[model samples]
Target: MKNILLFIALTLSVHTPLKGFELQHIVEPSASMISLQTQNLCHSLYEQKGHLVCLPWSNPIVDTGKISLLAIAKTNEKGLGIYQRARDKDLNQSFLEEVFRNENFQDISGFAEARALYKNTVFSIIPLHFAAGFKLNNPSLPEVHFIEQRQTQIKLSTTWFLDNPLTEEWMSYFIAPSIYHFDRASSSGDYDVLDSATTPYKDLVQNRSLKGANADLALGWSSKILWLPSVTVHGYRLFKESSDCSTCLPTYISLDSLNAPKADASVSWTIDHSFGSSVFGAVIQGKRLFKSIDQDQSAFAYIYKISRLQSYASLSQNQRSFGFLFDANLYQLGIQYSNEIQATALQPKRINQSYAYTALVL
Candidate 1:
């Protein structure tokens, strides 16, 4: 009887505890790549009104305006995984706000996300998960500008395990589908300064009161065919008809609706190898955006139409990880490139972006 009990205990200990508790933190900062003239234009617009009327010309300027910090904690015990993440963004100090502030910007914008997953549930047929997240932004501009965003998502995923006949090694295929609801609201401010000619500005602000549904599909395959490589593909689409724009600004000629169906697809390939206590890996990815049905040439669709390619390599020593990444167009590698703009020279001459990140995992 004692021997039997000892055998059962050893089996349980070997099968459980796949992933231990982990805590991580990340910081990302972006700077505007636009020219000085574009910065001046954004500043002038903000000065004319209480807030910037629209998304920036290059959009990269807007992207550069914010700094983000994130903290995450996760644990997987007995096949039940739980994770929580919190992110904070310095919206006022961002390149966007710096152009207007002329000094350091200082408003806090951030979000919190939590997710729960039950693996091998339902007779080991699928994994069930749910996630919830929210973000808020409070700008320091006059008249009080505030924005709040919320999302809820549910997913069902499954994996198929196989054995390679030639290598006699294990392989896996994974697939997941998710549905989510996203909503955002922007508090109405004193728009008295914006006149008829600046009607687009009003529309931009009021359009923040949007609600819609979206769906995501993801699939992945892993094998040791070529040095233990894996490939993953993900796609998402938004339902335009379900989007509500009732709170948008009123216009006599009925401006083109900015709420349009949008979709994006991306694929990534990665390979990893380990030597002693150190590991090395490389990843390549490509993303493409589909043109929206709303042919309003004045909208942001033009910017979203550009595709991007990304490549990165990483080295990790136990709990420490570091990586360098580059993103750009595959065809244009030089400095005189110009494919991101619609009409003006607002886009940067070179579309390349370089970034690096380091993480300490505990």
Candidate 2:
């Protein structure tokens, strides 16, 4: 009778309307139990489930302009380990930089993140992130260039889960909305040439205030034969004041107004098998920028379009609490490949640059 009642309560919670103050505490424990079961299947699965539950609260859409700190090290061809490089150039050339030269890549970077979860009438979570780094290099110029970077972000979200009769799986759905502020400042010193001529350096400074609205749907099957899939759609808009650039040249050309909205979509799939402990799995995910317009008069408008596709794959082993992932570019039909450098002064070519990341659950 308790199980039946629990099931009935779960069904009602899934269909409940979203209200500013509508808190439902009755279904919290059952959702937590399901989360625990998913965790037992594998650490990656656990992390994925946790992310799905917190997606709405964490604000995945806002561009905090944060880059991965661990990416400073370059992965070898074998994808085994990382080696020390002269400077972390890739860190400075992120997609975010397309909007502004806000970050300075450093040989050593630091980042810290914290999260909190609560259960009441609804599931709520908060996540905080901070990062700092620096970069110094001589790009065949007479003077040395120095860059320092810092970023911080915080988000609040609420989510709900239910059983799907058609797929015979648990469906986790969420609506996440968030706001964030980010800033990047760069400075360089003048250099003296052999003939005692001085070359001037210009400092670039920029900051943006942005808001995002996102929704996600995730399906977790009870049977091993089924695959887990999740889809997310997000939209972002910049504040009017944040669009003004005082020093550095605009990173991207805008059409009509800089406040135009940007749309993004992501899809992910995972499959679990018997291996380490009770859980092991592989995941493939892809993300694309669906909507954004550039002014034809802008120098980059001809070469750089807002359309982009990035895909990733990973293998998980829960017993060791360690996993690795690979990131690459995917070619799309009807999409023209342009020189990224000519379009955005970023990359020389649209090469399928590949990188690997290691996941360690602490």
Candidate of highest lDDT: 2
Give candidates' CA RMSD values in order: 22.4, 17.1
TM-score of each: 0.35, 0.37
Off by over 4 Å in 1: 1-98, 101-110, 120-171, 186-212, 238-241, 246-362
How close to the true structure is residue 65 of candidate 2, measured as C-alpha lDDT? 28
Q: Model 1's lDDT to the true fold?
A: 0.25
Candidate 1 similarity to native, TM-score: 0.35
> What is the lDDT, from 0 to 100, of the residue 220 in candidate 1?
49
Residue 294 lDDT in model 2?
18
Residue pair clashes in candidate 1: 65-94, 65-95, 65-96
Q: Write the per-residue lDDT of candidate 1 for residues 237-341, one digit (tens) a residue.
A: 434444355544442111111122222221222222241111122211111223321111111110101123122122111111112212232111211111111
Residue 239 lDDT, candidate 2, scale 0-100: 28
Candidates' C-alpha lDDT? 0.25, 0.26
| Residue-by-residue lDDT tens digits, candidate 2, 86-107 | 2343333333333123222222
